[model samples]
Each structure stands twice: as C-alpha cells, then as structure tokens.
Target: MIEYVARSGPPEAMNCPAFICDACRQQVVGAGIVTWATTIGDGRSRTHSQSPLYVAHKGECGRKVEAMLHAGYPASDGWIDLWDDIGDFLKQLTHNATNAFTDDADGEYHQHRLEGASTNGRMQ
Candidate 1:
C-alpha cells in the first residue's frame, strides 16, 4: 500500500480502514500517520503468504515498532522497555562524544588549571 503524509485535512481523512497499533494497542486512523504492513515467515521454513497490515501514529506507535525491529525484539506491552533502550542509547552517545573529545590531541598543551582553585583545604 502507498504511504503518504497528509498535509491537510483531518487525521481520519485517509480512505483506508483504521487499525490498532501492535506496540501500544492504540487505535490508528487516517492518512497523515504511518502505515505498516509485513509478511510473516520466510519461504524456507514457512510460506510468506501470511501478511498483515496496520496503521499507526507515526510519533508514538510508529517509533516503538521501529525500535523493536531495530533491537531485534517482538512488540511487547508498555513503553518501559523502549524507554530503557533510549536511555541506554543516550548514554552511549554521551560516552562516544566524550571519547571523541578526549581522543583529539592537538599541538596545543592541555593544561590542568589549578590557579585560584582550592585543593585539599589549600588554594593551589
């Protein structure tokens, strides 16, 4: 099915039928949001004839589905797991940025300024 962003009109303006989100179980309707469809099983073990279509809110349910697929997990109830994943991902990003900063060694001297700073109860 063709998925296009609806620039105007109501949320339920889409001609397609509404469906519940696989992640949050929320009702998704209309053309503005994202539409998802997938076929179940591989042709090797099982036939790919089984296919299911769904409509979802792009920001909420759509993100959850994308994260689940990226992390290689089935859609589960609640957003706690997704939140945890996001937290971890953010932590990694911080770590990587920090590493990048530290890794940059220019010709300029990296000075540890202790002037006017108190150290061990005495100003250094």
Candidate 2:
C-alpha cells in the first residue's frame, strides 16, 4: 500500500512574493489574509502550502480569497498591483475594483472550520 504523509501549519513565505489580500473594510486593518503568488505558466501551480494553488478553502475567508482570484485583477498604471488595504492603503487597490466585487462586498465571507484540510504543509 502507498502511504501518504500529512503535514500541518501554514506555509512559509517566499521571495518575490505577490500579495493578494482582502484589505479589511471595517477597521484600518484587514483580516482573513492569505498572501502569495506563483510562477506564471510553469505548467504547475503551487500554493505557499506546497499544495495546488486552487486547494479548497477551509474557512469563510479562504473561500472568499479564492473567489476574488476567479474574478481576476487587471494591471494599471504599469503596475501589476494586487494589494488591498482598508486604511490609507485603500487607494492602491481601487483600480482593480471596477467590475469586481469589493473586498467588503456582501457574501465575501465564509464560516471558519475547526480543522480538516491537511496536505503538503498547509490547510489545503
């Protein structure tokens, strides 16, 4: 029988990281954050967790982050900006919110699960 190794905890950050977060609209701070980026068109997608970038969401926030990805982010001002902030950083992300739903949009959140996902080294 083939044995599988199960991992735990969040993945480590990498160099040349591209952050894609949901800048909290409530306070000056954001929450439920998962910032990462991978090599484009490498014939494979890797999440910081060492799993597929499209790994299923474990909580409400993780799920929302996934949906935002599906919507897409367009580059502007010669900047491939994907950063979002609630306080003074909000301006940086406004350019990507034309037809896309704002981070504070309705249904953008999900319920958190205690535990379940376990792959490579993340919650999968």
Candidate 3:
C-alpha cells in the first residue's frame, strides 16, 4: 500500500502491490515506463490546459491505480473499471492543477501531443 523510491533496492523497484490490479498485483509480470501528455484549447483557443497521462503502457492503463496511489487513496477492495479510474484522475487533476480543457463539440475528440502522435499528418 506504500510506494518507495528506493535508492538501494530492486532495480526497477516496482510500485507497491496496491498500485496493481488483482491480476498482477502480486507479481511483476511485465515492466515498462509510463508516459503522458496534456493539452489545452478548443475551437480556436490556445493554451496549456491538460496534463500528461499514463493511460497505458503497451495497452495497459494502470494510471487509475497510479493516481489513487498519488492521492493516498487505498485500493477499492474490489474490482474497478479502467474508466472509473480515469474519471477519478480527471477530477483530481482538475482540482489540483491550474490547467484547463474544453471541447468544441464538433464531433471531434482532441489529443495531446503524447496521445498517439507522429511526425507526419498520419496518427501514430
């Protein structure tokens, strides 16, 4: 339930058991770095309005558990949907940071630079 940034411990020092799901909580089955990015503005507005996200690492969105850990939130004691964790992340970031986001309601979903982007016009 507690996270430790050890200076002299395991190499990766995987996150605590609490930050993992029931499927992998007890094991460090796979390891990879988490990534995130935030963007702001809709329509024509321009500004930094979002925050980096660690939605998934190779299709694994462990962010929900990460956010909970960051806020000192304990595990739910039951299974939780990934989006529910996303909802919690959204609320926490909205309240804790000054960044803001807005949707243009133009049938378009926005993405931050890290939200699957590439050098060319084609999406990654």
Candidate 4:
C-alpha cells in the first residue's frame, strides 16, 4: 500500500529531498507531501517506510491533480489531490455518515435478536 502525507512548509524549504509526481513526472519541492509504498514480492514485501518512494507534485502539476479531482477523476487514477483541506473535510463527512448507518444497523439487528430470543423462550 502507498500513502501520501502532506507537509505544511513551502516548496522552497524542501531543498535536500524532493518528490516527483507519478502523473506528471515533475519535481516536487517545498510544501508537498511525501509518498511511500511497499514493494510486493512473491513471498515477502519490501517496505519503503524509511525511504519515500515519490514526492507529490506541487505548483502547476499539483494544480493539474486538483483539477482532475474536480473534473471527476477517480483517486485510483493517481490524479486525486488529497492534500487539500476541503477534500479531507468531505472525506471525513462521508466516513461519519457511513459509520452512523452501520451503527444503526447493528442496533436494529441486536434488538431483533433479543426479541426473537424472548419470544422463543416464552413459546417453549
């Protein structure tokens, strides 16, 4: 699995190590986040937790990634910009809503099971 983390600093501060965008292949400097992925093998997987595999693109390429998300491009396409605050907010909202539904379903299932058990005992 690959994960991209966002950095708060500006692009110029990222001088020593830089990230390149997988979509546009542009060098990412400054405020962009780093991405790390594990290399999968037949038996064992090599982890790149210490070393970043790619640097998220900022500036023009970053803009393009944001545009892709706005244009309905899927995150699976590697064009989704997760660093944006708005996107994170929306994701959180969706997660919360899903959790609420799951909670409701679980409550209903438990209630029905309890009712069924009580009725079964009484009939016996």
Per lDDT, the best of the predicted structures is 1
Off by over 4 Å in 2: 1-24, 27-32, 41-58, 73-124
Residues 34-81, candidate 2, lDDT per residue (tens digit)? 332222222234211111222112256555555544334222311121
Against the reference, the lDDT scores of all candidates come to: 0.40, 0.32, 0.35, 0.39
Error of 3 at 22 (Å): 14
lDDT of 1 by residue, 35-72 (tens): 22233434456433211223345576767665544343
* Candidate that beats the other on TM-score, 2 or 4, i.e. the better one: 4
Query: Which candidate would rank higher by TM-score, 3 or 4?
Result: 4
Give per-residue CA lDDT, model 4, range 8-105, as digits (tens).
Answer: 57654433433456446555444554332222223324221111223345466556544543344333533223453333434665788777745665
Candidate 3 structure quality by residue, lDDT tens digits, 1-124: 1123234456665544222232233322344233333334463554333222233322343554355333332234221222334345546657747733443344454442333333442212
Better of 3 and 4 by lDDT: 4
Model 4: how far residue 109 lies from native, Å? 22
The runs of at least 3 residues in candidate 3 whose Cα sits more than 4 Å from the true structure, single-residue gaps closed, are 1-4, 9-33, 40-45, 52-56, 62-124
Best by TM-score: 1
Model 4 lDDT vs. the true structure? 0.39
Task: Name the regions of candidate 1 deviating beyond 4 angstroms.
Answer: 1-17, 31-54, 73-124
Ranking by lDDT: 1, 4, 3, 2
Give the range where candidate 3 is weakest over 10 consecutive residues by summed lDDT. Answer: 73-82
Where does candidate 4 stray beyond 4 Å? 1-18, 33-55, 73-81, 84-124
